[model samples]
Target chain A: MEEKPVRLDPWASAVKLEYDKLFRYFGIKPFQEVLPRVSQVFGDPLHLMRRGVIFGHRDYDKILEAYKSGERVALVTGFMPSGKFHFGHKMVADQIIYYQKLGFEIFIVIADAEAYAVRKLDRKKVIEIGLYEYVANLIALGLEKNKHTHIYFQTNYEKPYYRLIQMFSRKITMAEMEAIYGDLEPGKVVAALTQAADILHPQLEYFGGFKYVVVPVGADQDPHIRFTRDIADRFENELGLRRPASTYHRFQTGLDGNKMSSSRPDYTIFLSDPVDVAVRKLKRALTGGRATVEEQRRLGGVPENCTIYEFYVYHLLQDDRELARIYSECKEGRLLCGPDKQYAAELLAKFLEEHQRRLEKARDRVLDYVEPPEF
Target chain B: MEEKPVRLDPWASAVKLEYDKLFRYFGIKPFQEVLPRVSQVFGDPLHLMRRGVIFGHRDYDKILEAYKSGERVALVTGFMPSGKFHFGHKMVADQIIYYQKLGFEIFIVIADAEAYAVRKLDRKKVIEIGLYEYVANLIALGLEKNKHTHIYFQTNYEKPYYRLIQMFSRKITMAEMEAIYGDLEPGKVVAALTQAADILHPQLEYFGGFKYVVVPVGADQDPHIRFTRDIADRFENELGLRRPASTYHRFQTGLDGNKMSSSRPDYTIFLSDPVDVAVRKLKRALTGGRATVEEQRRLGGVPENCTIYEFYVYHLLQDDRELARIYSECKEGRLLCGPDKQYAAELLAKFLEEHQRRLEKARDRVLDYVEPPEF
Candidate 1:
């Protein structure tokens, strides 16, 4: 029998996330069965699903049904613009782009309010950084700027949004707030409600009320999804709100083979990182090789513990058969860490060049994608 | 030694308010010295100040200094539209009118946000009742609608106001929120911050930042005033905000002799109350009188405990000498309960008729007095 690792709070740094255990721990259903069916609906599942990054879900069957029926639905996700945009952020961007292509209404909330409240950034700076660092990167990653997509700052959507926050607040109590977000600072209280507002705003009457909604998030953000789902349930009878479905993706490993932390520049390959810098970072990244190249050839390697391998699985590789071959080669000592690192670096540099090109284009028409509260 | 009656939470029904004890209990400075001086500046002060209804203050000297120097200052107060407008509401209205005449810029917030958050009223209904029952009554009570006066709903002024609230929330913590409002429901948390925003809003750049400001509120609302003043102090270094000054009023006693409650309609003489209903309610009111008329002549009436006497002092009489005579007559047993009740009934009826006339006119052009947020 395999010994299971104890998963700590998902938000903590010690969380060496065992994604399979999280479904049972969080009382969420696994997404394994739904992926193939959803793939059939979308013709081909995105690389996130093909690579098994999206491992868990809650109420995702409703979303699958909406997709099958060609229902106008929404994909709601938010970003706190407090730090550099990295591969961890790219995971959400990729999912947003993939889902938008599938005709889902997209609401990308640049949580300027949350940035100001929880992260202590000024609203103007949050907006400026959000547009340049996060939103620009998102648009670069092919999040379409069209009528169906809305990217808004949390502070700008004040009128209908705050009133709607007030409405959601009626169901939530202080005890619940403390439970969801410990120690309940005033900013955290506002941020939590504002997030609930962000999730629910897409379903407001002006945006076409009462439709299936889904959020794509790393496992750390499940608490907010759970809180929002509870709020949606509270409004189900009155506002006809659907409890939001969520798909939880595995955390993208940092260049150091630890969880990506924005505070540690060496740990993240920021999207804005120069191609040379990214290549340098990847070259120095922790890998799964043994002490000597001869020993790695004899005893094989641990791709599971390799940040370079994770970069390939997460961002670089697209073909499932090719990824499988690389995994087997690492396990069997056919591949060396040196060449694997070099290959991943080249792939990253190429990806960054393309993204930077799109980012430049995204800068010009940024306003076309930005939206205010519909009400 | 004088026996002190236990006063319940002023927001609750069991409050048998011993108004004098409130100064020591709330740690507020007595307004006795300030009153006569303010009276000299504003010509006999308002009847509320003359009769000692305005008993305590925090930094009210700033207001007096503004008056003496002819400074363009602000008076900020808010009303919760939870019920019909009554004499308790009238106390704040009377002060707004008095200060407006003294050349202070007046900002009256119809707290539709607070009414929804704290009172659980629907926003639409709160707006409707706020206009018909509260704002209309304030206009009827001689609160002038001019370029210097701005009346607005808390919900309508969402943009700059919420950003300002975000600014205020940075200084206020969850512990302070619980201390001020107790139990810390999400609605109360937002409501508390909204009030801080309301007070600080008058000192914003658009309204002329940093001048003398005062809010006239019942003693129960002193917590919000205290909270806002602390927030104002926190911003004083950066924003040049003056710590808000406040004048606290004693609660208006109901016909049943407890503090007036919005839920206990029978205990209140609503400003919209019909003449016959007002007269009937007055007839059935509690009075500080002897059981028999002959015994009342020997003992005299306790004007201190008389609801009829309180009605006259708080709302009915404008002349200080006339009010003094009524107090003397009640103390001398010349003003018996039946006759005192009858006299108050006539005064209330006449006041209501004149108020109804103004309310009719205020109803027609109510929007002219209302303003959106400047920012």
Candidate 2:
């Protein structure tokens, strides 16, 4: 069933609303270009290339160098955890898995504190359900705990991050906020201020001080990425902290002609979806080609605007030349949207099945990595 | 040299300046009655009373109750290692000793961070001088390191006090400051709020919560005390933390009739002062009666205005009856200001003598009590 646009928090600062500005700032054509570079930087040792799917990145090469230098770069991601996980959850989980093979750390924050502060969660339940949801997914992702990733909530009060917050509060002048938020209304300024604190919090103490941290987020969360990086730059000098260069990756879209969101079940094909259910979902996938074969032959298709291609750009196939071949053939009416949809559906099902097997085997091994870090 | 009366900060609230209004709001009397009650409240338990002499308190009696409850309440007091010891310095040290006997945990924050924040403090000299000033005095005051007090600075970021600051900031409303301190000029509002965070930061954690705390301080510091108590009151219902109290005392003035400040050498007699030197200083102390004994016999002296009685009142003397007897004798000119001064001077010498010996013996003992509290 279709519904109206979600009521976005006016203070939440939408990522999609600032897309053009961000693209111009980063010198990227669009988010699609950033996805392909993930494979190159991650080092295609397994070579998941079927077609050119992923696109562009910022400082992807720098993070790649860390791997070459034997310094591990962590793939840091987070969940708001206000609700249950769905298809988009599995998509990000799969993305984390790809990086784990490349020997990167996976740092996942449940963001329970953020969720509680923002959405007004009952403090007691904030961690309970979310921690379970998170650990289960990480287990399903086949993440080996201490080695591959750490899934932690941000409610740790005794951490040195609290000290960093104290110090951070001293450095930023009211003049800065007056210029930016314009006399931040007291209604919830601390929460807004804490958003900056969250990204920089991990850098202050013994979390291998300021190494390459990549935030893998959906395109909608780009505002947080941009805001956090700005805070990191200012805080780095203010704190005299050893700050490593950071980058943000934006995932493309869903099966429908819109952004992928957990709340929108129809647009997403979850990793756990049965093969028949996946096929039916893909049949409804939005395509860029002209309606009929007669009209499609005369007019080239708009693959760039197609949501299916966007998903591939963020996830599935990786070979650039193969993607180019498919696009060109479709434009020339050599390959139709229906057949392409079936290929994507089958490809996704096979990947999911293989992932499920890996997840089942790696579940117990993940617990050790989740423990507190020693100094 | 005497400096000009310090000008109040323009951003400070009118209500904040009207310390009497604060007294009324807190259901406490004006500072006049409050100052004298310092030692009287905790009579006999402490070897020497340093109530009005010590003068300022954060939560003086709540801490006493906490101490009496057989709760671990270390007396926490301190000074920034600014310069050599003075009489005003001894006032605080004496108060710390009183609380130490009452079985409260004592923490002496050298205010090193405060020194750095307010003025330049040489890092190399800070810890050294702060230690010499506090550790020795604390020992002389009968502070057993294992039993009495622990002295530290604005410690590493690991301090729980920083966590308390964070919690305090979230609860206090900016409107409360506008009400308490009044209108602030542009951009100064946020920094105006940091004082509440600084003064209220005491590290005490309880069973999934926190403990009661107190600060004994002079009336002049009521601004900080009010700010901190406001923060505590603000968060009392929200965070489930105990509301800390402030014990306000009227400070002892210099022999020259000004605030008994360490900044002036003569204003305070150092606990480290030699017995003969202390007696000589007392001989020169300001007197408020007739010049000659016979001339003063017809005219009653201002015993209420006398600093000698203030000392006896502050440092626990034989009794209040002794103070009343001395007051009657001085007012009727029977007890000349000279003899009265002589008596107090001798009392102080003996007091410091015993305290110095105890301090030397208790040096290593204080170190053990200062260990990080177990949660």
Choose the strongest candidate by DockQ: 1
DockQ of each: 0.45, 0.16
- How much is the lDDT of residue B91 in candidate 2? 61
What DockQ does candidate 1 have relative to the true complex? 0.45
B171, model 2: CA deviation in Å?
4.6
TM-score of 1: 0.89
**Interface RMSD score of candidate 2:** 5.1
lDDT (CA) per prediction: 0.78, 0.55
In model 1, which runs have C-alpha deviations exceeding 4 angstroms?
A: A1-17, A121-125, A360-375, B1-27, B36-40, B67-70, B121-125, B206-211, B364-375
On residues A1-375, what C-alpha lDDT tens digit does candidate 1 reach at each position?
132332211122222256646766787777766878887788788887766777778888888888788786889998888888898899888899988988888988988777777888765666777878888788788877778888887767647666677677677888987887888888888888888888887887766566688998888888888898889888787667778899988888877777797888887889888889889988999998999989999878877778888888789998777787788778778899988888888889999999888888887766677743211
Model 2 lDDT, residue B276, Cα:
76
